[model samples]
Target: MSEKSKNEPFGDLMKSMNQFFHEKPVKNILQSMDDFFKNPFPNSASFHVELKEKDENYVITAELPGINREQIQLDVINNYVKITVKQLNIFTTEDENQQITKKQQSFQQSTRTVPLPHHINEKKVKATYENGLLTIKVPKEKGKRISLDGNE
Candidate 1:
């Protein structure tokens, strides 16, 4: 019997329901759900990496836990080094007849690209993996100094 809502003919009841949804807590929950759906798999926003410069080469070490060497890919393109890791898991439940009743599959992948200060020879790059750590060594390209004073 309250005043009718201008936006809806369902009267004050619908207006009250709509007001409930505008509460701060409810809005925050809805916003979180919206963000999650927008990017369901927000993986590796901050992958760990370390870089060191030596006299003749550069060394890079990355921490990649619970990952196997076969699941990792490394590439030296231009003056940058790209590292990618991918893991896949499959689970299934079988009955006495060996028929899968429930099956699930999950896939995850992360990638990090690091820029080098100097040009490197990709052919001479060396990489090794041990104990969830990856180390890469890249030799710097020799530079020839040019004299500007007309001197050889």
Candidate 2:
């Protein structure tokens, strides 16, 4: 028997089996597992951002180390506050010519959006960063409820 004719049937068999094993979901799950094992902490660059209601105000706390004071920004909307930590360039490498052989290395640039549980006075919001921790306080607005009459 010739080699071409002997291998033709096996090639066709592989083509049919390929479709079953190369499905999108199967490929995605395999890739996810591979990434999980390679990098156990995939989101190590992101810091912790927590929000809670306290003392009639909503307090937002974040843990950020080695971050400069100028690298933080806060934006407040109607009921949402977004905290953005700009890229912190911790170090850089240069060559003999001092031409920046390698660009700056930044640990992370992350943003966290938080929705206030209660109506808050955004104008009175205050933020303070100290000891590598950022804290923001948002005062709550007063609320009044009117009695609903039982009328069909």
Candidate 3:
């Protein structure tokens, strides 16, 4: 038999099997599995941001552990706020009594950017870090309206 005909039988079986089950249902099952594995660790070393709005300003707090103040950058462009933090792994060797041991391992550096609820004055922004928590105070733009009318 020719090579083409030799594989025709298997191909036909596969086609029949595919026709047996609806493609959409099968695809949904596979997609659900993919999403489950995509975020294996949902809360591992991930920073959580909390925004509190007051009469005159917004207080933004982020839990950033193992990050130094010098490694963070904050910027406000147009109406969006961006914050980038970088952390470096530090290794140390210590001697206990008379034995010396070396330990080596590092965590991956990650960056996250969040959009603010309203426009903020970048010049008046204040940031402070204490006990692995970063607190930022952004004075809300006084004249700017939080919503725009249909006219413009």
Per-model TM against the reference:
0.66, 0.60, 0.53
Best model per TM-score? 1
lDDT tens string, model 1, 51-71? 998988899999987789999
RMSD values, in order shown:
9.2, 9.3, 10.3
Better of 2 and 3 by lDDT: 2
Q: Which residue segments of model 1 deviate by more than 4 Å?
A: 1-46, 150-152
Give the poorly placed runs of model 3, Cα more than 4 Å off.
1-45, 90-107, 144-152
lDDT of each: 0.85, 0.83, 0.75
Please provide, for model 2 over 43-77, each residue's C-alpha lDDT reduced to its tens digit, 9 standing for 90 to 100: 66677899888767888999988887888988987
Question: In model 2, where do residues sit more than 4 Å from their true spots?
Answer: 1-44, 88-108, 147-152
- Ten-residue segment with the worst summed lDDT in candidate 2? 100-109
- After TM-score superposition, the amount by which residue 91's alpha carbon in candidate 2 deviates from its true location, in angstroms, is 5.6
- Candidate 2, residue 77: Cα displacement in angstroms equals 1.5
